[model samples]
Target chain A: MRAFRAQAAAELRLTARRGDAVLLNLAIPVGLLVFFSLVDVLPRPAHVAHAVTFLTPGILALAVMSTSMVSLGIATGFERQYGVLKRLGATPLGRPRLLAAKIASIAVIEIFQVIVLVAVAFAVGWNPSGPVWLAVPAVLLGTAAFAGLGLLMAGALRAEVTLAAANGLYLALLLLGGMIFPLSKLPGGMRDFARALPAGALSDALHGSLAAGGGVPGRAWVVLALWAVAAPVAAARLFRWE
Target chain B: MHRSDHPAISVSGLVVRYGDVVAVDGLDLHAEAGQVLGLLGRNGAGKTSTVEALEGYRRAAAGRLEVLGLDPQRPDDRTRLARRVGVMLQSGGVYPAMAPGEALRLFASYYDDPVAPSALLERLGLEDVARTPWRRLSGGEQQRLSLALALVGRPEVVFLDEPTAGVDPHGRVAIRAEVARLKAGGVCVVLTTHELEEAERLADRIVIIEKGSVVAAGTPAELTSEGGDAAARGGTGAGGGAGVAGVAGMRFGAPPGLDTAALAAVLGAAVEEIEPGQYRVADPGRPATVAALAGWLAERDLPLADLRTGRERLEEVFLRLTAGDRGGAREEEGR
Candidate 1:
C-alpha cells in the first residue's frame, strides 16, 4: 500500500509536469466548454433550453475520455518505450502495484478535470436539470472504460503509433460519439453504431445525470461496465513490461 | 527461506534464445557474498542476457538459475527476491520527467527498509542534480542516478551492467569506491564491463565469455600468471633450464652473443636471451637472481636499458581469451 501510494504520487507529478498531458486533459476540455457555450455553434436539442446546459455533460464526458484514454495511453506507451515499465517490473512494487498506481493517478487527474470543468460551466450560466450527483458513476465508469483502452494501446503498440492512434481515436469519438453534438444529428445507421460505443454511452449517461436531472440510463451503464471489464482484462493479458 | 551456505548466484546449463538463434548456450557461473564477479565479454557475447535472466527480467529457455538462493524465474519469488536484489540495467529505467531525487525516493519506497535518498544522492555526488529531470541530466549523471536507485534499497545482491559506462574519471573512482563499500557490506556484486582495468581493480574473480560460453574464469592474478606460465613453458623445451621465467622475472639489455648458460648457472634458475640483446632472468625476486644479472651486466660493461620485470597485464589475458571471436557476425539479437 505504501509502495502504491509512492508510485501513484510520482506518476501524478509526472503527469502534471508534462505540458502536452496538461493541455490535452485539462486545457482543451475547459477551452471547449467556454468556447462552445459562448459561440452558440452546437445545434440545441429539442428538450434542451441552452447550449451550455447540453454541453456541460458532453464536455465532462470528453474530459473523462481525454484524461483516462488518450493522455494516459500515450504517456504509458512512451513509458514502456523508455523502459520505465520494465524497470518497475524488477522492483518490489511489482506489476499489479504499478498498474494500480497508474489507475490511481488517472483518477486524481479526472477529479481535477471535473472540478475545473464544472466551475467553468457554472461561470458560463449553465444549470443542471438532472440529479448532478448521478454524474459521479458516469464519470467513474467512463474513466475505467477509457483507461482500459488507453493501457491496452500503450502496452501493445509503439509509442509513436499509440500517440497517433490515441489522438485519432479522441477526435473520432469526439465527433461521432455524440459528445460534441447529439446522436440525433447523425444518420440512422451511424447513430445506432455511435450509441453502441462506450464513448456514446458515457455521453448519454452524463447527459441523463447532469442535463436532464434523471438517473443514469441502464443501457449506458451496461455498455460502460462491459468495456470497463473487458478492456482492462485484455490489456493485462497482452501487456509486456519491455 | 534463507540458505546461508548456498552461492549468492548460481547458474548451470543456462540457455537463452531469441527465436531460433541462441544468445547464451550451456553457460554456468556463480558468485558468492562479498565478492565482485567481473563478467567480461566482447559485444554479443551473452553477458547482458545472463545478467538479465538472473535479475528476473528474461526467461531462460533451459537452466537452473538462482539468486540469493531463490529461483528468479519463478513469478511467485519475484516480490521477495526483488526486495533483496537490486539491478542496474544498461539503460533507461527511470522516467524522463522525474527528477533524480524523486526517482530515488520512489524506488526507495519499494523496500521495507531503505537507505535515505538524500544521503545516497550526496554520496553519489548527485546533490547538484537532485531536482534535474532525467532527460536533462548528463550521461554520467544519469548513470550515477541509476546506480543510486539500485543501491537505495540496500539490496543483498546487486547486478550492475556497465555501471560506469559514461562516467568521467572522478565519477568512475567514486563508483568504484561505492562498489567496494557494497562488498564490505557483504553484498554480492556481479558487474559486466569492457574496461579491463576496472575489472582488475574491482573483481575478485573475472570470467571472460566468448560466443555465449565461458572461455576463462579465475582471479586477476591467476589469469595473468597463466600467461606467464605459457611463456615460461614455451621457452623450457627450447632452452632447457634457461627459460623457466615466471611473471616476477626481469629483463635487461645486454651485448649480443653474451653467454646465457653461465648466467643461468649463476642465477640458479632460467636465464635466457629472449631477443638479440635482451636477457631475461626467470625469478628476479630471488636475491641471487637479481645479483647474478647485475653482476653479469657489470662484468661485461653492458649498459642495461628498459630493465623491468615482466608482469602480465589483465588486458593481454583478456585479448588472448577473446581474440578469435571479435568482429564476427552476431549469432543472435534482442538482449
Candidate 2:
C-alpha cells in the first residue's frame, strides 16, 4: 500500500510539473469560470440572482472533464507511445494498481479544483442552504463517473484517436452537459443523450446538491453511478497497456 | 532428489508463427549451469522469438520448454521463473522522462532482491548519467542502462539478447567484462548476438540457430572445426554423424597425437581423418556431430587444437547462416 501510494504521489507530482496540465486542468477552468461569471454574454435576469451560482458547479464539472478526460487522455496516450506502459507491465505493479493510482491522483487534483471553484463562488456571493454534506457524495460520484469514462477513452483508443476524441467530447459535453444551459433547453436528442453521458450526469448531480439543497433524488446521480461502474469494468477488459 | 545435470533452459521442437511465416521452427536449445551459451543468429533468424519464448513473453506454438526447472508456459511457474531470471530484450526501451537512477530504482522494486542502483550504475559506467533523464543519455549509456536493469535483480540465469547491438568498442568491452563477471559469479548466462567476436570472448558454448533451428552448436573452437573445409576436401569418411561437422569450417592449431579409432566411433565415421591428432568433419546439417567428436576425443585422453566455427563475430556468422531466410521473413513480417 505504501509503495502504491508513493507511485501515485510520483505520478501526481509529474502531472503537476507539466505546464500544460496546470494550464488546462486548473487555469482554464478557473479562468473560464471567472470569465463567464463576469461577462454579460449569456441571457441574464438583470444580474439579480447572480450568474456565478449557476456557473460554479458547471465550472467545477468542466474542471473534472479537463482533468479526468482531456489531461488523462493526452498523458496516457503519450505514455503508451513512449513505452511507459510496457516498462510498467514488466514490473510487479499490475493493471489494478496502475489505474488506481491514476484515479487517486485525479481525485486529489479534483479536491484542489473544488476548493478553488468554491472560493470563487463565495467571492461572487453564491450561498447554499439546508446541508452542504450532500454535496460531498455528489462530487465524489461525479468524479468517479467522469474518471472511469476518461480511462476508457484513454486506454482503448489510439493516442491520436484519444486526443481528437477527448477534445471533441470535452467541447460537446461543455455545451450539452447542462453546464452552460439546463438540459431542458437543449434539443430533444441531445438532451436525452446528455442525460446518459457521464459528464452531463456529473454536472446535473453537482447542480442538484449545491443549488437544489438535497430536496430531490436526481436521475443524474443514478446515471453517474451506473456509468462509473461500467466504464471501469470496460477499461479493465479492453485497456491495452502497451 | 538432488539436482540432476539438467539443462538451464531447454526447448525442444519449439515453433512460433506469426500469421503465414514461421518465426521459429522446431528449434532446440539447452544451456547448462556455470557456462555462457552464446545464441548467435542474424536479425529475424528467430533470435528474438526464441528468447521471447524462453522468457515466457511469447507463447510458443508447439514445444516443451523448461526454464530454471519450471515450465515457462505455466503462468504461476513462469512468474516464478521470471523472478529468478534476468532478461535483457533487444528493444525494451526505458522511460525517457525518468532519470537513470530513478528508472533503476523503479525497476529494482519489482524484484525481491536487487543490487543497489549506485553499485550497478558504477559498474556499468552510468554513474555520470545517474541523474540524467533516459532520453538525454547517449546510445552507449542507454545500452548500459538496459544491461544494468537486466542484472540488478541478481538473477540466477540471465538471457541477454544482443547486449552489444548498438554499443561502441569501449561499451562492447565493458559489456563483455560484465558477462565475464556474471559467469565468474556462477550465473548461467545465455547471450545472443550477431557479433561472433563477442561470443568467442564470452561464450563457453556457442549455438547458432538459422531458419528457426539449430544450425550449429559447440564451443568457438569446436564450431570452427566442424564448419571448416578440412573434412570436405579430404573425403576420408573420418567421422560422419559427429556434432563437430556442423561447425567444421574453422580449424585452429592442432594439439599432440589423438586416438583416431575412438574418435571415429564417437564422431560416427563420416569425419575425414587429417594428419595425426587432427580430424575434420563437414556436415552443415548436423547439430550433434561436434558433440560426438568432442566425446570421442574426451573418451581417449587426446588434446584438441583451438577450433573455431561460424563467423568470427556472431553477426557475420549469423549473416552467413540465416541471411537467405531473413530477407523473405522480414518482407512477410512487415505487413
Candidate 3:
C-alpha cells in the first residue's frame, strides 16, 4: 500500500510536469468552450435561451475525452516503449498495485480537470437547476469507461499506432459523443449509435441535469454503470505491462 | 536475507524459443550468494535470453528453474520472485525529462525497503548531476545513474546486462570497484560481458556460454590452468618449462622476440631458454610480470622486439570454446 501511494505520487508529478499534456487536456478544452459560446457562427436553437447551459455539459464531456483517452493512451504507450512498465513489473510493486496507482493518478487529474472546466462554464452563463451532486458519480463512471478503453488501445498496439489511433478515437468521440454538437441533429442511424456510446450517455445525463431542465433518466445511468464496470474489467484482463 | 542453504539461482534443462530461433537450449547453471558470476559469450550466444528468463521477463519453453527458491517461470510465482531480485536490463531507458534524483527516488519506491537516493548517488559519483535531468547527462553519467537505480532496491541479487558496454576506461574502473563492493556486501551478482578483463577482475567464477549451454566454468585460476596444461602438450612441448610461462599463444600474429640466453643470465638460471625467442622466466615470489621482464631484458641490451608470450588469456579461452559451436546444436564438437 505504501509502495502504491509513492508510485501514485510520482506518476502524478510526472504527468503534471508535462507542459503540452496540461495545455491540451486542461487549457484547450475550456478555451474552446468559452470561445464557441461567445461567437454565434455555429447555429444555435432559438428556444435555447443561454447557449452556455447547452455548452456546459458538452465542455465537461470534452474534459473527459482529453484526459481519459488522449492523455492516458499516449502516456502509457510511451511508458511501455521506454521499458518503464517492465521495470515496474519486476518490483515488489505487483501488477495490481501498479494499475491501482495509474487509475488513482488519472482520477486525481480528472478532479482538477472537472473543477476548472465547471468554473469556466459558470462564469460563461451556465446555471444549475437540479442537484449538482449528481454529476460526481456520472463523471467518475465516464472516466473509468474511457480510461479502460484507452488502456486497451495502449497495451495492445505499438506506441506509434496508439498515437494515431488515440487521436482518431478523440475526433470520433468529439463528433459522435455529442460533445461539440447535438446528437438530435445527426442522421437517425448515427444518433442511435451515438446514444449507445458511454460518452454520449454521460453527456445526456449531465445535460439533462443542468442544461435541459429534465431529470436524468435511470436508463442512461444504467448504461454509464454498465460501461464503468465492463471496460476496466476488460482492460485489467488484457493490459500488457510491456 | 533468509539464511536458507540454497543457490541464489538454479536452472536445469532451460529452453526458450522466439519463433524458430532457439535462444537458450537445454542448460544447467547456478550461482551462490557472495560471489560474482560472469556470463561471458559472443553476441547472439543466448546470454541475454538466459538472463531475461531468469529475471522473469521471458518465459522459458522448457526448464526447471528457481530464482531465490521461487519458480519465476510460473505465472503466479513471478511477482513473489520479483520482490527479491533487481534487474538492470539493457533495454530499460531513463525518462529524459526527469532529474537524476527524481528518477532514482521513483524506482526506489517500488521496494518496501530501499537504499536512500542520496547515498546511492554519492557512491556512484552522481552527486553533481543529481539535480540534472536525464537528457542533460553524458552517456557515462546516464550509465552510472542506471547502476544507481539497480541498487536502490537494496536487492539481495542483482542482474547486470552489459553494464560497461559503452563506458569510458575511468567509468569502467569505477563500475568494477562498485561491483566489488557489492560482492563484499554479500550480493549475488550476475554480470554479462564480452570484456575479458572485466571477467578476470570482477568474477569469482566465470561461465562461458556458447549457443545455449555452459561450455566452460570455474574459478579464473582453474580456467587459466587448463590453458597452461594445453600449452604443455602442444607442438612446442620441447620447451617443457615453457608450459609454466603460459603466456597465452597467438595463432596468426608474430610472436614476441627477446634474447633467451641473455634473459637466462640476468635471472641467474631462473630464466631458461627452452626454445628460440621463448624463455621460461620464473619468479618464486610472483613479481610483477611486465616490470620484471622489462628489467631483465634491458640489463642484457636484448632487443625485446617481438618476444611473443603464450599463456591462455580469457579471450582466447572464450574464442576457442565458442568459435565452432552452432547456434542450435547442443553437443560439443571441439576441445
Candidate 4:
C-alpha cells in the first residue's frame, strides 16, 4: 500500500510537470468549453435552451476522456519505451501496483478536471438540473472505459505507434462524440457508429444530468458499462511489459 | 541451513533462449555472501540475459536459479525476491522529468527500511544535481543515480548491469567505492562488464563467458596463470583459448617468423612469434633467460624493441580467451 501511494504520487508529479499533459488534458477541453460557449460557433443542438447547457456536459465528458485515456496512454507508452516500467517492476512496487497507481493518479486528475470544468460551466451562464449527482457515476464509468482503451493501445503497440493512434482516436471521437456537434449532425451510418463509441456514450450520459430535460439514459449507461468492464479485462490479459 | 552453507546466488545448467537465439547455454555459477563476481563477456555474449533470468525478469528455458535461497522463477516468491534483490539496468529506466531527488525518495518508499535518499545522493556525489531532471543530467550523473537507486532499498543481493560503462573517471571511482562499500556490508554483487581492469580491481572472482557459457572462471591471478605453462609446451586444444599462461614471457619486437624452435631449445622453454615482428618466450623465467634472449638476438643481428617481462597482465589473458570466440585465434591453435 505504501509503495502504491509513492508510485501514484510520483506519476502525478511527473504528469503535472509535463507541458503537453497540462495543455491536452486540462487546457484543451476547458479552453474549448469557454471558447464555444462565448463564441456562438456551435451548430446549437435542438431544444438546447442555452449553449452552455449542452456544451458544458459534453465538454466534461471530453475532459474526462482526455485525461483518463489519451493523456494516460501517451505517458505510459513513453514510460514503457524508456524502461521505467521495467525498472519499477523489479522493485517491491510490482507491475500490478504500478498499474493501480497510474489509474489512481488519473482518477485524481479527473476529479480536478471535473471541479474546474463544472465551475467554468456555471460561470458561463448554464443551469444544471435533474439529479446532478448522477453525473458523478457517469464520469467514473467514462474514466474507466477510456483508461482501459488507452492502456490497451499503449501496452500492445510501440510507443510511437501508440502516440499516433491515440491522438488520431482522440480527434475522431471529439468530432463524433457530440461534444461540439451532436451525432444527429453526422451522416446515417456515421451517426450510429458515433453513438456506439465510448466517447459518444459518455457524452450522452453526462448530458442526461448536466443538461435540461435530464433523465435516465438507459442505452448510454449500458454502452459505458460494457466498455468499462470489457476494455480493462482485455488490457489486463494482453498488456506486455516490454 | 546456515547462510555460509547456502550460497547467496546459485545457478545450474541455466539456459535462456529468445526464439531461436540461445542467449544463455547450460551455464553454472555460484557466489557466497560478501562476494563480488564480475561477469565479463562481449556485447551479445549473454551476460545481460543471464542476469535477467536470475533477476526473474526473464524466464529460464532450462535449469535452476536461486537467489537468497528463493527461486526467482516462482510466482509466489515474486515480492519476496523483489524485496531481497536490487537491480540497476544499463540505461534509461528513469522518467525523463523525474529529478534525482524525487526518484531516490520514490524508490526508497518501496522498502520497509531504506537508505535515506539524501544520504544516497551525497554518497553518489549527486547532491549538486539532485534537483535536475534525469534527462538533463550528464550521462555519468545518470549512471550514479541508477546505482544509488539500486542501493537505496538496502537489499541483500544486488545486480548491476555495467555500472561504470559510460561513466567519467571521477564517477567511476565513486561507483567503485560504493561497490566496495556494498561488499564490506556483506552484500552479494554480480555485475556484468567488459571492462577487464575494473573486474581485476573489484571482482573477488571473474567469470569470462562466451557464447552464453563460462569459458574461464578464477581469481584474476589464477586466470592470468591458468593456461600459461600448458600453452607453452604445445598444450591447449583448438582455436584461441586462454593466452598469457601463468608465468610471464618477454615479448620484444624483432623480425617476424624468428627461429622459435631453436630458441626454445636454448632457453629450455617454448617460444613463438605471436605477431609479425613480435616474439613471445613462454618461459622467460630466470634473469639468465633474459640475457640469453638478448645474446641470441644479438648473435642473429636482429633488432629488439620493447622487452616486457613480468606476470602476464589480465588484458593479455582476456584477449586470448575471447579471441577464440571470434574464431580468429588460428595462430595460437596451430602451435
**At residue B32, what lDDT does model 3 achieve?**
85
DockQ of each: 0.68, 0.23, 0.48, 0.85
Docking class of 4: high
Sort by TM-score, best first. 4, 1, 3, 2
lDDT of each: 0.83, 0.71, 0.74, 0.84
List where candidate 2 sits over 4 angstroms from the true fold.
A43-48, A129-131, A213-217, B1-7, B226-317, B323-326, B331-335
Residue B60 error, candidate 2, Å = 1.8
The best candidate in terms of DockQ: 4
Weakest 10 consecutive residues of candidate 2 chain B by summed lDDT: B231-240
- Worst-scoring 10-residue span by lDDT in model 1 chain A: A208-217
| Fnat (0 to 1) per candidate | 0.88, 0.25, 0.67, 0.92
Residue-pair clashes, model 4: 3
lDDT ranking from best candidate downward: 4, 1, 3, 2
Indicate which candidate wins on lDDT: 4
How much lDDT does candidate 1 score? 0.83
lDDT of 4 by residue, B181-288 (tens): 999988999999989999998899888767777777778777776354343212222222444445567777787888899988987778888889888887645788
B22 in model 3: Cα distance from truth in Å? 1.5
Candidate 3: CAPRI quality band? acceptable
- Candidate 3 wrongly placed segments (more than 4 Å): A44-47, A217-219, B227-252, B255-307, B325-335
Tens digits of lDDT, candidate 1, B147-260: 999998888899999888889987898799889999998899999987889888889988777667776677888767734443222211112223222255676776777778
> Candidate 3 on B170-209: residue-level lDDT in tens?
7787788889988888888998887878888889988777
State the lDDT of candidate 2 residue by residue for B258-301, as single tens digits. 54465556656544445554545444424576666556557666
